[model samples]
Target: MNGDKAPVRVWCDGCYDMVHFGHANSLRQAKAMGDYLVVGVHNDEEITKHKGPPVFTEEERYKMVRGIKWVDEVIEGAPYVTTLETLDKYDCQFCVHGDDITTTADGVDTYHIVKSAGRYKECQRTQGVSTTDLVGRMLLLTRGHQQRGDSEYKVERSRTESMSEDSAAKSPWTGVSQFLPTTQKIIQFSEGKEPKPGDKIVYVAGAFDLFHVGHLDFLEKARAQGDYLIVGLHTDPVVNQYKGANYPIMNLHERVLSVLACRYVSEVVIGAPYSVSKDMMDHFKVDLVVHGATPVATDVDGEDGDPYEEPKRRNKFMLLDSGNTMTTELLVQRIISNRLSFVERNQKKEAKEANLWKAMNADQEK
Candidate 1:
């Protein structure tokens, strides 16, 4: 209610399983069209019945949606189908989604009702990434996608170049695209705030691939420890060097946006050093450095001792349990274990989308 004229509330709903920067980007766009953004997350049962098994549970998906910076409210266990009644109940002026297909198991568009009522709008889908593509990368163990470092100049190059050449060979449903990153996009996602004086700035660093509930929980706990929480996002090459074997499913720019979108993050250090040096700590005015319970990967070449040595020496380091043991490795195993299901799911989804496009085009021709 802006001066008696109601605010333009926007509604966006999805399963949001394996939440990524793509999802964040969509939410950001949806929010920009209205004063308030209300995101509805489908539950696990509904998602499994309609879209196949979700990577994350309903509770996790709900929490992840709430964490997105642009999301003003979250409706848990929302219906798979968007109804005008749902919108009117929430007083939303319109609903929004990405320019991608979302259908039920019976090949019905989830937003068809809203579309028919002229209560829906579409935003550009972020290219080069999707849950299906990420699952395929895990199932195929595609190591070439990892960003590699050119030691001579300390520069990094994305393997997506080579991967793009072979894109024609891949299924349209699961094919990967080269993610075009821009400083403007980064600026849009960033909080862009400096820590105030007397503020305790807590720091943590990681690859944060997949950006699941585990990362969300860890960030929440870390944020509780300080006035401002600055996350250090390691470069893709650095993550690959440490994790080795098709690691960092998301690239550096992707990971940067993912971390910055989290509500718990006050700021992020892009391409942060793997080793937290004294100079680095002093630079951020970091009062404490926290690490999750997962075993720390050794330094890039193992030539440098422990990565946390500087923090340890300064007595500013603390080990956080986070309670949830989920990791990116565990996520890969989940995808690999259910490879056939996800593969079939992507194929069916693409087929349904193609059929819809054909029908729509035929109508337009008529």
Candidate 2:
């Protein structure tokens, strides 16, 4: 810790099950207060014990948090019980948490340990948004079968059943034989046509709220990786459900247009409630799922004593490690903090120009 260098250590922790703007904001603020921000992700057992079941698995949660811009490293363990030993391990100059959790149930002040250690501060919570609000809003908005009546659901089920029956009836072969391809030549041709170079296929999907250069670079790399690049814009409802309420600064349509305008993206696909599913991958046959090298992979201990085994299951996914880049959340914070100064500077310039014009007019009249 050289006096001339930046503060090298900071500690922050959260459930981080769904990466949202609020989470990003907190991380950015924490990082700004220090040089390196070490994030502790709540393990599945810990989250389940304190809160209800998390929408994402522990591994997924870890990956989402790691993907954030300010997160220097992710500790995959229970964060609920923070100890002096843990704080000392990182040689952290301070421990940061949202101000929203400053009070206890009886209104007694909390976070005494960090304070005693001469390192504690609360970052401002992004107002009017949270994970709970997002989930509740989604469940309330969607029209369920119970409210619409069972007949509608039943009717849809019957239609699907009838369609299957009709398709089976049209087949020339009887029984299971109808399911098999009539000619082996067609199957061979399809198999031979596998992923080839120059195929104009596109791939794009994420909670891309605050668009930044990293996103742009990733899209550019994705486009270069394929003949075409189709971005999957997550819908507002889906985004709210997956991410917390304090997410997606831009709405679904805005997000769509943002990606559409990008030179790399040729088309856009709306991502549903969660991660890209097998159905979507199969339908698009995306040769690559381009991602940045921000360590967006969850480490889980396996029988072989390797933590990296879990993320490897996504074989079709290609991890493209882009250089360290700024994120939209960080950009927003910088703007907000400097907004007043920026406004005042602009106003002063405008006044100066007006005064110069008035003096010039007076001189001309003289």
Candidate 3:
């Protein structure tokens, strides 16, 4: 608990549905308030009663929360209605929440009881993001553009259809999502080890955003070229420079896990530099630096620039042909095309859950 600064245990509770960077950032803030951060996730029924069904199930939400690097502990099936009792049970000094207006089904402020008890703390809401905003991005992607009759969406959609058979449905997070990753698993995946003598270290960098089969195939081919593979993921802004217009649908953290889950990937460099520097090559003992058929980095003025400048200087640069043209743009278009399928899937899930909820309530009454 950070050298026992009174061992503050801070608690935060929420549905955390469709967990994303917004959720991650809030947990970060909550953890900053105390030594130990404990997250409480409400059950599906409680959420359904108050906030409607979450895109991901309660179990899914629980697992996602547990995976965030900031989370210390997670309270599964926490009560939707917070109480001093719950906070005391966890030894949590205060309950933390974003500065958003959250209300119950009856439009009552949910944190009233806690606020009245003088244990409520509010964290700044992450601007430009929310589960609702993300959901809208998927559902109403072609909204304003549709009204304006923009041709780019249609063009991208058609281009995506021609590329591959893989479909994007629901949130892309659910597509490549994995069970909670362990420290050992992460270390092993990241290859955070001293390289053995004669080990051929290959370095590659990109957004690796949606993490589709193309990424798998590309990594497989890259892995075949070296004993260790280090993938450098550019930051979101840098990715946007090349990807353009609502690209990198996943944030940097999400993209990290997505790439880490790849069997062929040895290690991932979070917020890796766009230009491969000599220092990086020396540190990792990278023998080969590879770039795929995607766009290379550009200078601030927008002219094309060498992404592998240091690698090139050291004669360690090479271009790889993974022969897979699939990209995140294509994946997004696939989702756009299969939009109705996902909507129907959600509808079915809601109906099934509603029936199950009714059955449980009836049994309780009996």
Give me the candidate number with maximum TM-score: 1
Better of 2 and 3 by TM-score: 3
Model 3, span 254-344: residue lDDT tens: 6776576455667788889777777898888899998887867567225467757778888888888888776667656655676665444
TM-score of each: 0.89, 0.44, 0.52
- Expressed as tens digits, the lDDT of each residue in 99-132 for candidate 2 is 6542222323345677677778888765433444
Clashing pairs for model 1 are none
Candidate 1 stretches with Cα past 4 Å from truth are 148-175, 362-366
Off by over 4 Å in 3: 1-6, 142-231, 234-247, 250-283, 286-366
Q: Please, what is the whole-model Cα lDDT of each candidate in the order they appear?
A: 0.82, 0.54, 0.68
Between candidates 1 and 3, name the one with more favorable lDDT.
1
